[model samples]
Target: MMFRKKFVLFFGFVLFVTVAGAQDRYFTKTGKINFTSKAPMEDIEGKNKTVTAVLDTKSGALQFSVQMKSFEFEKALMQQHFNENYVESDKYPDAVFKGVIANNAAVNYAKEGTYTVNVKGKLTLHNVTKDVDVPGTIKVNGGKIEASSAFNVLLSDFRISIPSAVKEKVSNSIRITVETKLDPLKG
Candidate 1:
């Protein structure tokens, strides 16, 4: 009986360790966002250099963050405007998201499958914080995991003051896209 108890304990310990190590980390140095506005008329898109995403299978937890200063556009002047007047990247250098997949057990990272999940988290930009619910797609194929999410942020929510000179040139909403390859977390 004692031997059986010891075996059970050992098995349980191993299971715990295995489960803990199953979290996956997917990262990218280039994440993109595009903004389009009418009237004054402008098209803007930028890429960030530091982006990290953490996914936990057991808990269906997802956390992501990016450095605001990393955003770079084709035009140097436009990029400067974005950082200085729009995003104020120097002041609010990072944007973070923390949430869980609504359907925890429905996603299987080990096999090829597509799962639609609702992600709820706080998004901070230009020193303003807002709660958001975003829909995302998670696909696991050939031992690789790809996560994609698109969300919109309102300029007013972030307190980004639009200058009267170009008030109509910028859009009130900004669209963001996140994509990356996930790597299994180590013990």
Candidate 2:
């Protein structure tokens, strides 16, 4: 009886601490991410609207999760080739980015203003991880926050090679954009 009671009390304490720590966190499940490849002969575009993201204000930790197959392309054939040949959705089904706000202390989350910030983190896709330093903005308004960033990356960096058939037509650099509005967690 004593062991069981102690275990239950310990579990309760851990749960309380976790919930307390999460009060300063903000999260959204419907974040948006878009990628564009503007090439000489062809332009490819894809958008994913079901990205899940979490940001802990206290620790400056931010993370994003996205399913590889969730990205939608305008052409069905392109989408099929993207999953089967490019990203291989069956083997590597998710892409994640875990980073921290470099200027966490400068931004006042309680104030209604927009703050420019730098985020440093690791982006993992297609079983490859790369370090990225991106410029972004954090907007605090009406007790809510909106975050956005746009950056260019080389497809080859993640071992994603453009197929020979379209190699000459596609650009090596691809532009990526992220946008998300987050609400504070209430516990």
Each candidate's number of clashing pairs is 0, 0
- The candidate that wins on lDDT is 2
Q: Give me candidate 1's TM-score against the actual structure.
A: 0.83
For candidate 2, what is the TM-score? Answer: 0.88
> Compared with the true structure, what per-residue lDDT tens digits does model 2 show for residues 168-187?
66778989999999988776
Q: What local distance difference test score does each model get? A: 0.74, 0.91
- Can you write out model 1's per-residue Cα lDDT over 123-152, one digit (the tens) per residue? 766667788888988888876677788877
Q: Give all TM-scores, in the order shown.
A: 0.83, 0.88
Residue 104, candidate 2: alpha-carbon lDDT: 93
Q: Which one wins on TM-score?
A: 2
**Candidate 1: which stretches are off by over 4 Å?**
1-20, 23-40
Report how far off residue 151 is in candidate 2 (Å). 0.5
Error of 2 at 45 (Å): 0.7
